[model samples]
Target: MSDRNPGMELDLEWVSRVRVNTQAVLKRAQQIQGRKLVKKQWEAAWLLRAVTCIDLTTLAGDDTPSNVHRLCLKATQPVRYDLLKELDMHDKGITTAAVCVYPSRVADAVKFLKAANSSLAVASVATGFPAGQTPLETRLEEVRLAVQDGAREIDIVINRTLALSAQWEALYQEIRQCREACGDAHMKTILAVGELGPFTTVYKASLVAMMAGSDFIKTSTGKETTNATYPVAVVMARAIRDYFLRTGHKVGFKPAGGIRTAKDSLVWLTLMKEELGDEWAEPHLFRLGASTLLADIERQIYHHVTGRYAAYQELPLA
Candidate 1:
């Protein structure tokens, strides 16, 4: 884990005046989408880089130990050996950043990863993931239990009701409680920006979450009607930059949901490079929370290596 954001006293003053220029943010999103990596080798290289930042996740209701085992295996060997060999990147020890699963499946994920002798970190979604409607006590207990189950990272969902009602201090304190419950595990705060009202509210929530010691601020839970979007991402990226400038604390940004293509992954990396520079593009400072995204990326890589797209059964399921 990176140096934990030691957290600061909630600055109500900073949270109050936060406002986002909607049109500017929209325009920036368009620009990011319009960017394209020029050369085949350069595009392939960036896609490989994106592969290393994936938080390979399985958060479905039907998640089982067997499926989690498959997910872990895929995480360990995300790209096929032949493909990596074609790019001469096989020996670089490339792999997804982590394997994210439900709190109950934390033990299974840990067990499988260890059995494979793979060092990939195990992450668990806690504190009523996708819906932070549980009681505070319940949420805290959930976080503690996931840690006890051997999760090195904890993804917590912030209560949207508090932020929607302009409960800044309440939101900070609650996130603080969740951070305290995380112990040694890294805490990833999910703003669920789609449900958090407007872009301004998204910015405010990002600030509050970072101040409360979130190692990373995520965009969505993938369960919302709207998940990660570029416009909302611009707001969050600026908030990360603002916090870093003021406190010298470099927090991470993760845009989960709706990001499922290799091209989409490159655009996200571009946003990070453009907004926060190259350091944030590393696995420690950035993560792509995705499920099928890896598969499409591998397909793209396959095409890059062979000059033609692979058949449906050409690559193993991710």
Candidate 2:
């Protein structure tokens, strides 16, 4: 689990008064993605930083112990050894921040990491992930079960119905219960921004999750029709900034789903740098919930070092 924030109590008045400027957010998103373009060595460095912040994830119905073990091994050494040697990063002990899997696979991930004598954290999506339509008690029990199975991070999906209905108190109480069930594990609240309607709702949901003691506010669960857009990210990042300013606590931001390319990772890194300053760019504060993204990053890094693009067969399966 990442560091805990010990979030403040729910303030319905503050949440109700929160507002977002859609035009301003869209303009900022456009400028951020178009203006800054790092090339060559600087781009490679930024990609490397992004690699460290990735929560290498494998959440599928077909997930098994064998596949989860492979993912753990890949998480231990994300980039190839020869490539790292060429870049002089071989001795840096580069690895993904954590391995995110479904709640049922938490034990498998833990066992694999332990057998390898590695310290990689295992993150499990609990509390009826993606849709979060299950009963509250059942959801909380799911969180407890995942933690009992050795998961250090619990990714819980918020009840979008409550947020959409503007039931701030209910949403806050539900998330608080889930956080309590997490025990010592870090709780990442997925707002499922794609289904949360406008940017205003996204901003408000971000605040509500942070106020309810979420260690991280994630954008999506990778099951929505659309996920992790730049404008939504800007709103959520600013909300995190606002929360930090008012309460003296820094909440983390995660942009998951549809983030597949190395360039996409660079854009998110730039967003964190420009919106919340450089402190949010670190792995402890930022995480990219992605599966296939690592392969593209490895390909880019290989090209950066060897001046030759690597074929798909050359990179390890993510």
Candidate 3:
């Protein structure tokens, strides 16, 4: 009887030990790296190509009536007539994609887009816009308004109040609500990672945005004095790659603000590709926020495609 009791106790202990070991193994297996090194490098190359083609310009032109009017008119023209003339003369080039304009004029801009040759996308700033402090209802309504106005994409600023306060649940809720509000439109959630303060905060915010149904996690709104940066994007991309590995969901990344020249775009694109891989190379996964980048990219592509030196200033202003 004594021997049997001892044997039973040993068996129970063994079972408990085995169970703990099994759980550890399972957990280890579940942790996967989202991006492979080779694929990461390939993505960097494509992103470079995409960024190089962006032409960035400020919505508000210099202090001149004609320039200001030109800016306003281009916001709704079929093509800048001046720009077309430049293209006709082979003096400038058109970018890989179209410019991103304000929500108020999206429909008019889309109306004038030469669909056959150039692609156009309207970028609407949503959810109380630059401040992002309004009631949820007001935020949703803003998104609706932009969509009705023919905006193909919506760029939303994250609730900085919630983020800064460490009210993650509220932050997540805001993103979810905003996503639902967007309907069919792709949602780009700006962490305003810069406003988030540190790398840890940025990383956490990145995770929050992705988990809450953000299609693309954007760096910042140009409204901020300091916009996107290298490390900010790097950390965001790393978080995205990790999230995909865990949930099988691929979230895109966009580094807006201050991306001026083709070279600037290329650097961010390369970083994205190298960090996230080919899955991030598409417009669905990547984008640059700039008004003037398109011209420089046009010049590069023109030189490559047509074998010539084309200056951006020579391109049509539309």
Candidate 4:
């Protein structure tokens, strides 16, 4: 596991002077998909590993204890038992990295996970997630409330308005407060990249978040018109690497929204391995913020095992 970053004083010089070569980032991202594909058993193995790094999520307005129970069940058993047996991986005890939900559902996720006797992390989206428009006090209270409810990870969305206005100090302090409220809970800061205009600001936002004690710097909230594009992720990866070099602290990276295919998961894993090395490829350091991704991954695993794709009905719903 990568070492936890305790955060550092906000460095305006580093944050303000950050730059991202848009063309170079875009070119590298394009090349990731072009890399040689992992096939057969190796491909299956990678997909399974990817499953372990997924933040299984359900953030809909209609979410309740019932569906949250199902989400927790899926997290504990992401792959079908029979499918795992086919690959002789049943004994491996595979599970998703965590189950993510709205702050209100934190207790339900925690309750279900405990009943299952699983210690899988329960991540809550706090601080007015998806928009971060709530007042600062209210948002901080939400973070504390989620932690009080047993969320082990808090995915906080940064105020894009601050980033857009270049409020570096305010952004840094705000995230620091969220980190403080998190206490022992891990903090994953969502930069909402799609809304943050330009590659340079994306890079800077990544830096400020890491310096503010974000355990993971996420690509988006998955609610924007554009989410988790490769270019934006590549930029974030560079910042994570740079931070690691300077502080000897490791921060994880998560890409949410529009990532829903087995092949797509492989591409993301490949990106992490290439950009951040194998250390960041593990479940603790790398996570895919996805809801529909597991189904597709399970389908691919089924096809690989049986040489025939299973219909959607054959696999259990998440």
User: Each model's number of backbone clashes?
Assistant: 0, 0, 19, 0
Task: Please list the residue runs of candidate 1 whose C-alpha ends up more than 4 Å from where it truly belongs after superposition.
Answer: none
By lDDT: ranked, best first: 4, 1, 2, 3
Best by lDDT: 4
**Could you tell me which 10 consecutive residues in candidate 2 have the lowest summed lDDT?**
1-10
What are the runs in model 2 whose C-alpha is more than 4 Å off? 1-3
lDDT per residue as tens, model 2, 1-318: 345789888888888897888899999999999976799889988898999999999999999999999999999999999988988889998999999999999999999999999999999999888799999999999999999999988999999999999898899999999999999999889999999898889889999999999999999999999899999999999999999999988899899999999999999999999999998999889999999999999999999999999999988887
lDDT per residue for candidate 3 within 1-318, as digits (tens), equals 000000001122221222123343234323222222233334334433464233232344233434433433443332334433534522333233334555565565555444423355556777876778888888888888888887767888898988777677777787887777777777888887667776667777777777778877888887787788776676677778767776677787778787766556656655666678865755567777776665565455445444586665655563
Over 1-318, each residue of candidate 1 has an lDDT whose tens digit, in order, gives 567799899999999888789999999989988987646999899998999999999999999999999999999999999999999999999999999999999999999999999999999999988899999999999999999999999999999999999999999999999999999899999999889888999999999999999999999999999999988889999999999999999999998998998888999999999999999999999999999999999999999999999985888776
TM-score of the candidate numbered 1?
A: 0.99
Model 4, span 250-301: residue lDDT tens: 9999999999999999999999999999988898899999999999999999
Superpose all Cα atoms of candidate 1 onto the true structure and report the RMSD in Å to 1 decimal: 0.8
TM-score of each: 0.99, 0.98, 0.70, 0.99
Clashing pairs in 1: none
lDDT against the true structure, each candidate: 0.93, 0.93, 0.61, 0.94
